[model samples]
Target: MDRLSRFARRIFALGAGSSMALVFLVIFVNSVRRYTIGKSIAWGEELPIYLTIYGVMFGIAYAYMTDSHIRFAVFLDMLEEKIKRFVLIACDLLTAATGVTLIFAGHAFAMRRGSVASSGLKSTGDWLAQITGIPWLEWVGKVGTWQYAIVLGGAMLAIAAILRLSERLSAPSKAKEPVAPLAAPAGKAST
Candidate 1:
């Protein structure tokens, strides 16, 4: 389990970091070209948008894996220990369910829209064709190619949620803080 978690952490971190780097690189290059030569790559706009989506998805999974995702700690703190445990477990289950839903929904959406191609990417294909013998552009010009990031993010989220659930189940409960005593039953003889 530890090894699996470590692997997932690495993958999520690398994916998010790489996506951000690529987006930055592409935008920088495009800006330089536009300013210096008064021309920018046709697909520059579209590529960065897709890469940003990928980066956000990976970053979300990475945040959840690191236990940094949002939570209502104030509400949770108000509950009894056992109820808190139950609520935590339930929350984990809910997160896992959401992830699974994303997987199926994303897959269906991608398949339904897979045939449509982006005009920018289609034009960019010509640029790539000059270098590669294979028709790689045709494969990736479709929106569905990048939409798979949704599915990938869903899978990572599910894995992280389940791992957290397991850890929660195995860990010992924390000691609750002592509650203050009542006001001596409204001053009963002061003793």
Candidate 2:
């Protein structure tokens, strides 16, 4: 399980990094073209938006897997150790629930948008088909394609949350230190 989680984390990182890199390159080249030749690639604007969405979605998963996401720990710190553990478990459950919600919402939205198409992406598909010599690639530009990122992100989040909850539950609880009196003994009182 540990190894699998590591592998998943790596995949998430790669997906996010690659998407960001591609988005940057496309936007840069398009900007250069627009400035130098007064023309922009048809897919430049559309492609970057989709890439950014994918990048952000994957990055969220990567963050969750790596325990890099932010948490407000001030209140948690005030709780007893055992209560803290339960609270953490509850938080994980909530996160998993949210992820599940996203999964359903994203799936429904993607399905509904399946028939909708983007002209810019169609042009992109045509260009890609010409360059790659794949005749069928011309139909690759569906608006619903990028919407699947929400599903992917949600799945990753739910899985990571479940794994974390399991690990937390299986781990041995820490022994709390015995509380000492606030006031020092007469012999040990401060001068």
Candidate 3:
């Protein structure tokens, strides 16, 4: 489990780094192009947008492992113990449900749109026509694109991770702060 989690973290980190680098590089390239050529690459903005979207999609797992995502703690904290547990469980369930919905809905959406080939926001998908001379790699683009697959896989992974977290949350966590006493009744011992 630890190994798997570590691998997931590494994958997420790599995606994030690649996304940021591409975004910055794209901006830099665009500025340079616009300065020198009096215009920018039409594809520059699109590439960065894709990278940003990819990063967000891939960052979910990392967010979970790092606990970096925001949580609304005030209401949760104010709840009594049993209610807190129930609320946590419900939150987990809702997260998992959302993940599952994304998986199915995204897959359906992708299927409907996957047939449309990208012209790269600039050219007429001509890049692939000339690059296939080697023959073996000819059908690469014709093959199903991995981006959609990533969406489906990511949604499943996200849901699975949520369920795993749900199970973990069900068990009492030992790393919690030392158990504190409830307020003492008037006659109770102080200790």
**Candidate of highest TM-score:** 1
Off-target runs (Cα >4 Å) in candidate 2 are 126-139, 178-191
Per-residue lDDT of candidate 1, residues 73-169 (tens digit): 8998899998999998898899889999999999998888877787678666655665686676675678887888888788878888898888788
Stretches of candidate 3 exceeding 4 Å from the true structure: 80-86, 117-119, 122-125, 133-160, 163-191
Q: What is the per-residue lDDT of model 2 for residues 73-153, given as tens digits with 9 covering 90 to 100?
A: 788888888999999889889988988999999999998996467767987777788999998676558787778889988
Give per-residue CA lDDT, model 3, range 23-71, as digits (tens). 8999899999999989988667656766676677667656755656668
Tell me which of candidates 2 and 3 scores higher on lDDT: 2
Distance from true location, Cα of 3 in model 1, Å: 2.7
- Enumerate residue pairs that collide in model 3: none
Clashes of each: 0, 0, 0
lDDT of 1: 0.85
- Model 2 lDDT-worst window of ten: 114-123
Question: Per-residue lDDT for 135 in model 3?
Answer: 43
